[model samples]
Target: MLLVVEDDQAFAGILKNLSHEMGFQVLLAGTAEEALSLARDLTPSAIILDVGLPDQSGLSVLDRLKRNVHTRHIPIHVVSAGDHAQTALSLGAVGYMLKPVRREQVAEVLAKLEARLEQRMHRVLIVEDDERQRDAVSKLLASDDTETVTAGTAAECLELLRTQTFDCMVLDLSLPDTSGYALLETLSQQDAYSFPPVIVYTGRELSADDELRLRRYSKSIIIKGAKSPERLLDEVTLFLHQVVAELPEQQQNMIRQARNRDALLEGRRILVVEDDVRNVYALTNILEPRGALVEIARNGKEALERLATSQLHRELAVDLVLMDVMMPVMDGLTATRAIRENPAWAKLPIIALTAKAMPDDQQRCIEAGASDYMAKPLDVEKLLSLVRVWMPK
Candidate 1:
């Protein structure tokens, strides 16, 4: 659900509709008090907060939400007509969407939140001797999305490790079983990649050496006390958010590669040899936008002519050639051999397009000195992959 905290009815209506179009249930809040009340009630997945609330300053509202255990996990975006983006961020807003926000800007902000929500937050394992303290830790950390498991001592924690995996760990320094120091040493021995991040949420005060020793095993040590719950949540949330924000770009690259888009495939010269005009147009449609300068030939005979001319003229040098298997004037096999015979164009790559079911077609093209062969009707991605391989970087 999306919560829009705005005083302007007209603009609020616009945002509500836009969010609905993007598949979010919209809730409207006109004042800071109303926004806070709605936030506590709905616990929105994301918030679009207007800084110009009637009752109180929006930053104050943001502060209140951040301090609350139930609402801080919900990401907030500051919307403003003025330059308060930096200030809002300092106060704990995840992002700032400037106003008057257009449909495109709203769409972009939604996309960011969508990406963030798609990632799973950390699964934490809490290790403590005191049952009350352990249950309290669980209560503070667990939400609709986060998972928590408790281990009372080092032996129990080690036993759990044999069967479970955690994203982060909350530890108690003083335990009846093995000490936290021993547990840290044991956990530190796991291969770096598989080791879960450890957070030392112990009450005991430490010397310089103990602190240094804990540093090798855990992410941080938070001494348990009055303000610790909020501080602990803040630290844990930072780790979880970091995982979402630093997610490998290749993971997000699935959409781009979905249509076999060659986004970075640019600035190359290619010649397409095909008798059919439709095939030429299809090839152009895909290649031109990728910044390729595509030239055309009616048949394999004209392909040879173009290759000969390109070899003689340096500026016209074709980076690669896509040769059609059959043509009215001359076949692609003969043109490929001709291209290979010339010492100047010998190193040039010529890929043959052939029927998908013909087993001997590829071997025939290879024998004729073609660089590679792809079956038609061209798979756009396979074609682009072949182009990338042959084109000069």
Candidate 2:
């Protein structure tokens, strides 16, 4: 099934006709809202998105789809009038096409989607220094349709990658011959080797710097622990686009439990400090459904007062804060530093939100004591993912 999101009636008709010629059942969405609803309800095999939508940008729609566990594995191709190809691809769209597209271009995109849907086998590379650990992961992820390849060092991993392409790679940061960090850097510098979506599954305790570095090279990072195996299965299956229902009952249960942990926001209190009522409303809509108690603060000064009062009245304790950077009375950066200075709020997670997504802006937010940073206009799914990752576990 192919879901087409386009407000332009003529263009949508053209897309529908082309898709039918390829023997794909077509579902059309005239607005972003409709697209999101159909996607969440039907879980289409692939999506063809347009940038111009009545309610929201197509890029945000793409962001939300990729963040959602059920919809993340589905391939998406963007057809836009704007030059947002880079952004769309970064958000996980498989391919991007500009407006005034040729028939061959659309056909090519559909062909690629067909190939992905028809491919029966998925190859995975497990790169771990310990032979026992490598073998164990291979066994755990083993399936009738999956081919698992193992490497005990960075050199061997690189050698395998140079010759053959893989669907995904499960990497460990600790390698005997070279560190995982070095290997990733090597891959980034060289263009000959195939670099697949890497899941960094390791036992190494990582510092903030280490994590930030790894985020550049890896798709998901799982620290070895009691529930690590289940989480690994969940991530691997997602990247492989495997059919969960077809898997063994035991693996299915593991995937279910791993996904259930995403409900970390349930019953948690989040303080949303923003001057804009529109943003406040949007955040509320996203968080409240997840069972999070949403509290609003007009500005940075109001946020500080609320925190102070919450501390004085233990019953009002907030689990996390979504601080908007640009605000009257007091900016979020100032508020974040003040909160960090307070001994009582030392462990509280503060995520800084800003309209500017520039590198320097991110650096400033980090320097001001923000636990993390996100750019506006907010991507609903990414915001939820960040909240889950930063919220107290």
Candidate 3:
């Protein structure tokens, strides 16, 4: 399905009709809120966004979507009166279209999209010690036409590289023969496949310096223990260089369920306690697509109030909380303690988010009753992985 987010009804209709004629299932949203809601619920293949909106800038919406692990992977285009192609591209938009929309330009752009979707030429190298994790990630990534090569250690990976070429590499940092970092540095020196887009999948908690160093050779980083096998697939998809997202809704859902740990979070309620509006928006963008009903509070006090009122007045139960470590009035650690103190919510899953990666800080969150703790500037894929583990399948 392709979603066209536009405020102008007539223009929206024009785009919808045009999309359908071009062999696409179409969905339309008139406001940013509707756009966001539908983007999550429908999990559209691509989004044609309008810059001007009744509620918010399409650029803002794009920023939020790109931060989401699920929706971030979908292709998006900007359709607007003014040219925002440069800004949009910098922000992750695939392409842009000017207003006074024409069938020719739409056709040309979508033809390119269709060609991308129908792609089949791709191969990935999986470097990990755990066979179970390796297979799980490989399943999500291996379409019928794609080939996956697995290596149990950095040494094995190096040996494979000398003999065969690959489109991508999924690396686990800790290896028996050598460090994944050393392996990446080694690859950078080799003349093999032009530094194929690399993704780091590891259990090690990296410091800022470590992350900076890895960024030299890798496209992304996802911590392993955070239910991260699916994330490895996500990173692998980035290198696949193909597109086929224009399938029917049922087919799309089926494929999504298959790729997404073999299950989608269809009915779930989640609370995010964070003072940053942007973070809340990003989190909502990610969770909504996974079928979670999301609610937000700026700080711990409001979170408590919302939790209490929902349980007592609405007779509703919140399934999980994504709590921010630093906040006004009440911080995540304190909030975690308060929630645990209430017997009814004692065992509720609470995941802490912090800018700090200090061991002491993580321990504090755990001691205060948080189920897990993640470093912020979130690794989006890692965040979702953790959420999936804590929530019921």
Candidate 4:
């Protein structure tokens, strides 16, 4: 559900219609008073607030929401006819969309808002000592519609968990009352299921044993200060979404079918041809971890050499090749075409790996007879997921 708070009746109606068309239940309010009342009643998934309101300024309403104990966690996107975007952001708006807004722009913002809400609604608790940090984290999670409760200390967090259920926790390792690690130990001992998935956000150094200990409790540990808050949120959002959600039976069957498809040969011998060491390392890291027997060919000549040798051996039939678009001796496009023209490897899966993410580049790669295309710097999780879907178990 979404709350659209715009004073312009026509605009509010348009927003409501668009939101409903986008498959969201939208509640509209033309004045700040109505908006506040509706917000209090609905506890909406996201709020699109106009800076201009009839009863009160939109900024004032936003301030009220943030200051209120009950409404502080609602994600608000400020929309304005005036150029106060910076001010709106500083005042705690998750996003600022200027008027007269395009339907596409609104849709995009709503999409992100929905994704964030889905992430938050699942269940997450934020534990931090600083009020500002707690609010910031809460706001971040709120944007995703993730149900988040903030605790100023470890003791408070434990108390909350005792009474309520949470799927995950974002804990500051340094707490005013008790150590985060000690809290983890305490939670672990309470009951097996009492310990929720935890993400450690701290500046303190964590040893391998500490990581292992957290993992034992089904927690993910991340070093703070190394990444921006946005990046941290992204990682947390992705991790929680993946770890907490179980695949539906239908989706699971689809995945199994994709895994068993004849076109996707199981445990197929793959040759990863790339020049960049980082790309090679990352690909190897993701694929090897997933049980793919990955062999590296640093350049096109080396790749061809491997193919030629494989043809002679008959035992080394390369079922798939991940060719980097750019490399020495012959680029991936040329190499892919060469391999495609050959009868033995014509039907083989040849996916292109390229730094180019533009649509034109993808089209070019397709024209070169590439079976599939993935962009670089590779998303390891996405890569692995795609591989599992395309390749047999």
Candidate 5:
């Protein structure tokens, strides 16, 4: 759901039409007061806030929302005809879409807004012993322009869970008050409602049994290393996306159908093989929610094995494969070569998921038997259009 707060009636109508066309449920307001009242009454997934409102400035409203406990986390995309992009961003707006907004631009902004909301809507509690590390992780989640709450220790995290709700958690294995595994065990004993998804983000190395045990309770486990902040963010995003993307297709369809009944997809399967967990998770999260069954393989070898073993491949029911280039245990190029060697899988639609945006890289993937190529950090909206093109009605 999105809330559009704009004073101009005609412009508001235009936004509504575009939002509906792009498959978004929109709530409109002509004044800041009305916007605030509606927001207080019913929380929205995202807000497209105009800088100029009749009653008050949008910045003031944004500040109010940030200060309030109830609405602080709802993502806001500030739209303005004026030159206040820097101001909006500095004030904590997720995105600033400039005005005289083109249909394409609006679509792009809304698409990003939806992605940001989807990532954070499932709340995750962060439990870290180090204040600095805890702060850093909190900023990363909030920096993507999403909502997240943090706790410095396991005790605080458990207390937060007792009073509030969360979609998942990022637990540091080494905590001052208690070990991350202990918290996981306690949460598992509780019912599913009290048990949010857990992701272990710790520096500690574990035995295979410990890793398996953590997986039994948590969604994913990440080892904190000397990886760059960007890499860490990617891992976190990947973990969150996987958890949310697991929702039933009917539930996802309901979200789409509520916004636009015309939104339809006759079930299509897209197999994405990417070494980077973040890319795979983000892409899968977006695609699965749109009525596509997404199958993920960590590396090229795993992908090949799945292609050989899956019943769908035997029937030629697998629609597409989004193959990543650089991976362990056989890169995409080698995997594609192996696939082409086989008569049965030679004609499968393969698309390269490459970080190399260069023209030569695209040509290489295509030469390796990929039908097409998409750059890394896949945009949710563009990928949807590409899927529609390949899987035509």
Candidate 6:
């Protein structure tokens, strides 16, 4: 059963016809009040919600439904002509589709909903060298609808991933045979294995460079602490899309406490070192709205000058540097080496950006003391994620 919540009768009819072709029993609601009533009265498999409504806003309805324990488990996909995709996603919507959508796009959303609803058990893989820690984490995440598999090394983890499918993976950086970074790199290349969203749960604190490397493959990083278990549980359930109502009361409370995302880049200062004006504009656009102060340096020589000037003024000290690999005067590699040479800026985080993401380029960046490397034609979301990860706490 699928709930179709829309004010437009014509479009609702079209959605119903399409759903019928896919063998779904559709229930219609023309307004926010009716939709809420229908949702509470009958819990459907999934919901297709519109942002606009006659009496109230659909985003309000979404928030209400997601907050309620009874209906929070039902996946909601928001369909709107407005630009509310980011807001909808943050509010727990499974997906978002802009209006004037093609039939194929709607069908894709339906297919995803169907796939999620059809899954019976969510499997999680725990890869940790410490036997006691692995068992404890497994016990903490264990549930009736969840199955957990434990592996002691990268080899064992790779074998299990090749043989079976999993919803998520909890990894530790330290392993006897191989590091977690290597395992992730291997998984990215092999198409034979079922790659799952990874949560890096480790006892050790990561350096800026190490953290940058891990960000390429891991979805969330959890350093072990008194409150880490709660956060780990929250992230796992989010990825699994488990029902909050079905979880134990204590677990639910812990999850609630850890659900808030940190404002990583707020009030932070980032120096963008690029010769290209277009990249400078793009980077500024992405960072400024997130409450970051962006400073630009046209070339490597100018970057050095900026750093030197900042050293004399504490208020102008840059928190991070986005270094373009190729520049007119003294390239990114040289700038990075020069930065490393200075004792004051030795540990400063500098992420090198290159047009080519080949192995040679990545190695060159690392050799030049870059904290990490990102390829050109950047993925906007991924770039943001990396920035958040590297941002100093």
Query: Which candidate leads the pack in lDDT?
Result: 2
Stretches of model 2 off by over 4 angstroms after superposition: 8-14, 17-23, 40-43, 50-52, 56-73, 78-107, 215-227, 263-270, 274-300, 304-393
Of the two candidates 2 and 3, the one with more favorable lDDT, higher being better, is 2
> Of the candidates shown, which would achieve the greatest TM-score relative to the real structure?
2
| lDDT, candidate 6, 47-129, per-residue tens | 99998776445776776676566787888999998866655654557778998989999899999999999998999999999
Better of 2 and 3 by TM-score: 2
Question: Between candidates 5 and 6, which one is better according to TM-score?
Answer: 6
lDDT of each: 0.73, 0.83, 0.73, 0.70, 0.68, 0.82
- Model 3 lDDT, full chain set: 0.73
User: Model 1, 1-393: lDDT tens per residue?
Assistant: 989999999999988988898889989999977898899887889898987676545766776675455676678888888765544653456678777777898888888877767767558888899999999889877765578999998888887877777767777787898888887787677643334656677665456477667656434433333225555655565445432223335422322232232322444689999988888999999899876889999888898888889868877878899999888888889888888888888778788987564778877998999877777898774577567545532
lDDT of 4 at 120: 27
TM-score of 2: 0.64
Each candidate's number of clashing pairs is 0, 0, 4, 8, 1, 0
Residue 341, model 6, lDDT: 98
Summarize candidate 2's per-residue lDDT along 1-393 as a digit string, tens digits: 999999999989999999999999999999977999999999999999998786556776786776566787888899988776644654556778989999899999999999999989999999998888889899989898999999999999999999999988898887899888899998887998998877778775556577678767534443433337887888788667676777788888988877655335666899999999999999998899766899999999999999999988876899999999999999999999999999989889899999987768877988999977888999876688667656754
lDDT of 2 at 350: 92
Q: Global CA lDDT of candidate 2, please?
A: 0.83
What are the per-residue Cα lDDT tens digits for candidate 5 across 85-150?
544543446668777888888888888877765553556677887888888787666533246788
Model 3 misplacement above 4 A: 1-54, 57-73, 77-115, 129-146, 153-168, 186-192, 216-218, 224-393
What would the per-residue lDDT of candidate 3 be over residues 1-393, giving only the tens digit for each residue? 889999999888887888888899988899877887888777888888998786546766776665454577677888889765654653456678888878789888777667656655668888888888888667656676667889998778888888877766777787888888888888788786345556676776566577667656434433323445444444444335233353234434444443543232445688999999899999988888776788899999999999998787643568889999999999888999999999988778899999888768877988999977788898776577567646532
